[model samples]
Target: MKAKILIVLGLLLLNFGLQAKEKECIKLHVGHNEVPENLIEKKKSITHTHHLSGHEPVHIENHFGDVKVRVWEKPEVKVNIEITANAPSEKKVQAFLEIVKIHSEKVNGEIHFKTDLQCLASAFENNINGGDDKEERNFLRVDYEVWMPEGHDLTVENSHGDVYIPRFLSVLNLHQNYGNLFADHLKNERSVIDLNFGKGFIKSMKGGQLNARQTALLIDKAENVVMTNTSGNVKVLMADHVDMKTSYGSGHIDKVSESCRFQVKYAKEFILGEIMADVDKLEIESSHTNLELPLCVKGRYDLSTNTRNTDLVLKDQPKVHYITTGNDAEKRMLIGTTTETNATKVRVTSSYGRVEVK
Candidate 1:
């Protein structure tokens, strides 16, 4: 009877040990792997590097600096950070560096890199963007250059700085304000890019789902894109399965391979190029703008406009029907569609503007 009780107690202890091992959080400090080295003397620049094991989600946060990421063929992750500042005095610069601390914690295969920036959040209040709200002055900036293995998820949040990633093949989530973003090539399955009052440019990206919101956006190629912008222009060279909304801006879409849905308000111009899908779906809404949608192939279309200067000029001249509603001055809504079975469904609406579809 005593042996049986001892066996049961041993099993219970083993179970608790396993649970504690699974939930262990390892906290690392700087200078463990390499010493903090100063790169530049006059500008007060310093660099640090940390090497990590295993693959997992990584999060990085910076208040004022650039962040660059790249993928390598190794199985480990390496982080390189550089901090630069231009202060009024050397003592102030040293004080700023002392206040900025790098904290890294790894738990359950996830790594988080953070810095203490609460000290400077109340110091630098300056009018930067010609707006009523005062922005924070960047007395010091910490730029990061990280290299990780492929297929690891990453999230970065940076403000008043730039973020650039080249050749990434993982899930990426980025948030940047008052800075620029440039992703050279992205092979991720999913990504979310959010920018406020900044410019964004992407090139040669392949993904199943992508969501981006920027003040100005430019993309070379994309698939399954959802984007929103305000007060800035957008341009895309080639895309598939896109849904976009814009306000007080213009859009120039070059080639669409599948489907597109666009909504614009107070736009200057909206141009849509060729549609090359077998069964495409195009939907557009415009107000106080001019739109041009030139169809390069034959498809079924449903178009409507409340302005008198709208025109539908089809070169092939398929079967069509039309209906007009309301008075000539206040409203002159025209709805038209082509009668065809197994055809692409296209719907468009415009108010106080001209839309030409061909």
Candidate 2:
């Protein structure tokens, strides 16, 4: 009986051993010829030069990279692209390089450059299923440095990177996301900037319109500016003839030379450091806002408000004459004139907020 029991036990142990050996063999077979878990980095750089008439428009579109543009005297466009890829193996790096490329062509007398990542859906799927979840997937990025002739119109669309233009003297249009814009000495007549979730700094802007959401913008000097902001902030050191609208945002203008118009709504705040005496008009309309502006002793302003818990404070000046009308429960209006003729019209209308003119 003891000899029979020992034989049965030996058979069970051998079966268990065989099962474990089979599992080990299967694991090794599955992992055979697979790429190692080590990371590999590769970089590629390419440059292109395109002849232009110096009057054609240039458009650039990119994703996940920085773009730097500068003006040059040559009547041509020069583009330099640097591509970086990180993968677990040389095969993956080559795959990324084959899919990620920059395509440039001429369309209707315009030069167009675009970053092409072919079939993003398939690429993502392949990367996800390539290896363990804890391993790093293939990553790629491209950075652009472009030089174009002066006087040519420029448009840039980018995401997840910064756009820098040191000096652009022609029509410029920029649309960016999750990045910052740094432009200095921009002299476009009809420039447009649409930014989201970023910050913009402009040293000087001649004429432009800005649409910002969840962003902050600072302009050292601006003229003929039009801006609309949501949940953001804008500050201008010197402005000439600005039309601005804000929602859940704040703005500060250090000085206004010609005219200014601001429409604020939904918990916005604005502050005007100074209004020139020769400013033709200043108009402000607010709902649930807090606004403050310095009163020009030699300028005329018209103020009106209809509100609940709104206070209008005005500073007294000998040269200015103030006329008040209406009741607090209904509508309140105040008009101030520094001179009987050519009075700088200042109008303020608010509801559920405060206005201070000092």
**Which candidate tops lDDT?**
2
Summarize candidate 1's per-residue lDDT along 52-130 as a digit string, tens digits.
Answer: 5555788888756678887787766667777654323454345445546677777677777876653434322321222
**Number of clashes recorded per candidate:** 0, 2
Best by TM-score: 2
Worst 10 residues of 1 by lDDT: 1-10
* 185-235: candidate 2 lDDT, tens digit per residue: 888668998999889998988888888999898989888878898999989
Clashing pairs in 2: 301-346, 302-346
TM-score of 2: 0.78
Question: Model 1, 281: alpha-carbon shift in Å?
Answer: 2.5
Candidate 1 steric clashes: 0
